[model samples]
Target: MPVREDKRGQERVWETRGSLPEPMLPLPFTVRKTRKETHDTYTLELQSESRPGGLAFAAGQFNMLYAFGVGEVPVSISGDPAAPEVLVHTVRAVGPVTRAISGVKPGDMLGVRGPFGTRWPLEDALGSDVVVVAGGIGLAPLRPALYQLFRRRRDYKRVALLYGARSPRDILYRRELGRWDKRPGVDVHVTVDHATEGWGGNEGVVTALIPKVEFDPAATVVMVCGPEIMMRFTVIEFQKRGVPSEKIYISMERNMQCGIGFCGHCQLGPYFVCKDGPVFRFGTIETFFGRREM
Candidate 1:
């Protein structure tokens, strides 16, 4: 049994002996395949031994991915959560944990905790225009949103995606990006900061793509993720378009030790990024935006 302190400061047993978090909704999944998207980016596809039962989630939620001994990290569920048996995660090899994840084989075991976090406002964007801006590996978190919109292509009016990478070789999800470009009612634009000889796309910051998007400021939802500097500039671009800050959502990245709220490593101002959000409407954090170190 585990004891917890209540608001009255009295200890209470929160669980009975030998009981564990409702049997942990375990699904036996195996890595179907792994694809290297970039030098450091990899996509892992996990398939259930059989079709999973009733696994569903909103567009922007994430999962805590566990690799045997390397520990766990909260990664956006890149696949359609509705098809829970076929889960996918796109990860960048930025640290030891990620490297370990990359080394996992087809038969390896991985644990998934949840489809956590408040999702992107998919329902609110119905019949409205949407602009998705991503930079570098930041695009991983937006994959689900893209899938949801495309899955129900008739629900929305127009959708545009603008993604920026550091170099031509750094682009992630090239295949899917190409597919999205060909889809009806969806426009996908890709750019790189430093172009190589073979590169023919736009060669500038992602903010440069903002002017090309067509949307009504009052009826649009802008979802952005990337490095802090990229997000700062993207928000400014949205402001220039007269979009309300409240209508723009941004995913914030931080060091989250415990996927749950127990550990405070992911705290930002009055909220915990791991709990209150990894995604937040710009206006909700507007006061503390760009002031973390100041």
Candidate 2:
């Protein structure tokens, strides 16, 4: 049995290679649904052909989506954890692999290799006020965490979501946001960097919406996912609000060539983003975060 040690030095037995499928081998997944979320983004709903049921994944974990000959890239699992029957990934068409992945229509086949990496610390956040902050396409990864929070809404106190997009047309889940905003005990605030006509909502960075959410700083647990600059400033804002670094978490992006840690492309300092994290408690990585050349 292979053992994996977490940042805290706790060791857990990972799967034995004999019982599980090879980690690097791609499993066939058919695209059952694909829809445009924005001008450059698409949400792909896939179902495994070889594996029955669905791919089980936790919030903030990602998959290595391969576009056949074009290659593969890391995309966060964006669907509800409870309904893993339809494996979902929100892809931004920024590179060759992503563009190919997003171009696939219904009935097309793609390769999927993982439900990998660290997950949002939702279990530890029970009974605490949960605040979710997202920027641009970063909203995709945090969507699952939001779904989990709402499913067990009674376990948490004062749940809130603050999201920022590049413009009014760039928001990822417009209909869902509207519905979440109406949920009792949940506060959903949205902002756009550049507002357009017919947009009457707030217009500013997401950090501006922080104050609008009421939470006890000491009892609040925050999850942030966005560009590095946006995450950096969001952490600063939360720090000023008195939230402890250990109580705040953030997701990171890197050139992850392998889902496992064998490939060092996703290394950040002593940790491997692909293995140790893509989600990390703020204090754990604060030393190198936002530092030049990191």
Candidate 3:
């Protein structure tokens, strides 16, 4: 049996390859703890049994999470690489699989497949201003990029994050966002589509907040992740502000069954969304952006 250790100092027995009929990828991991950040959002802290080594990935990469007998889903690594042993993922309970994940307890066993997909170009953004725009639960993948930037604060120029959700209560990573707001070189602006009583923040579509940001188009990279419609409008807005199409990067979401390229479920035209990217330069994917049935 393969044993996995968790953050809270507990170990669980994981079935080894010999115990199963076919070979299995036994990535020994333990569920450290589960915490609810909001009414429906939860974060899981997973610890690796071995002394964790660096996960060589650019920011914005995602991993395939496998529940013992349930199913698998692609989730972003929301933790920083600076501390690799303990991995963190912020998940929202929207469906059966995710709800099962949310129900996981400390010391539970789970499997992980990758740190796959094309990553956000943090190196390209070096010395250039960055504009990160997120909508709804789309902020999950962007969290890695935010973590990387703040971890090495001097690598990039001014950085700003514009996030939007249905209501103030729906916002994810409220605690981390609060810390980002207080950071000297970062500006975090948030908005809601509808306002509830006593809400004091801006109330409007996320695009409405873009006009207030100050960044030179020629020296900035805009990274966006959101609903297809939201991204469409965001690209248009960036164009109006003189930001080149090539400079804008966007993370696309699709029904990904397998993290590897073998699955056809995540195909987009000639490119496999799982292999080629979940993140792509806007100009590289503009043709498929408006397709009716992508």
lDDT of candidates 1 onward, in order: 0.77, 0.88, 0.78
Instruction: Give Cα distance to truth, residue 85, candidate 1, Å.
Output: 1.4
Query: Candidate 1 — which residues are off by over 4 angstroms?
Result: 1-29, 48-51
lDDT of 2 by residue, 1-294 (tens): 234665564222243122117788888899999989999999999998777678777788888899989898999999998998899999999988999999999999999888788788788799999999999999999999999999999999989999999999999989999999999989999999999999999999999999899999999999999999999999999999999999999999999998788989988887788867788888988987888888
Better model by lDDT, 1 or 3?
3
lDDT by residue (tens digit), candidate 1, 1-294: 234444422222223211113223434457878888999889998865554442355556666677776677778777775576577888888787788888778888776666555567676688888999999988988888888888877888779999999999999999889988998889899999999998989999999998887999988989998999999999998988899997898988878766566788877777667646677778887877788672
Cα deviation of 209, candidate 3, in Å? 0.8
Q: At residue 273, what lDDT does model 1 achieve?
A: 73
Give the clash total for candidate 1. Answer: 0
The candidate, 1 or 2, that scores higher on TM-score is: 2
Q: What is candidate 3's lDDT per residue for 167-272, written digit by digit as tens?
A: 9898988888998899999989999999999889999999999987889999999999989899999889999999998899888888887766777888877666
lDDT: worst 10-residue window of model 1: 11-20
How far is 132's C-alpha from truth in model 2 (Å)?
A: 0.2
| TM-score of each prediction | 0.87, 0.95, 0.88
Error of 3 at 58 (Å): 3.1
TM-score attained by model 3:
0.88
Inter-residue clash pairs, candidate 1: none
Better of 2 and 3 by TM-score: 2
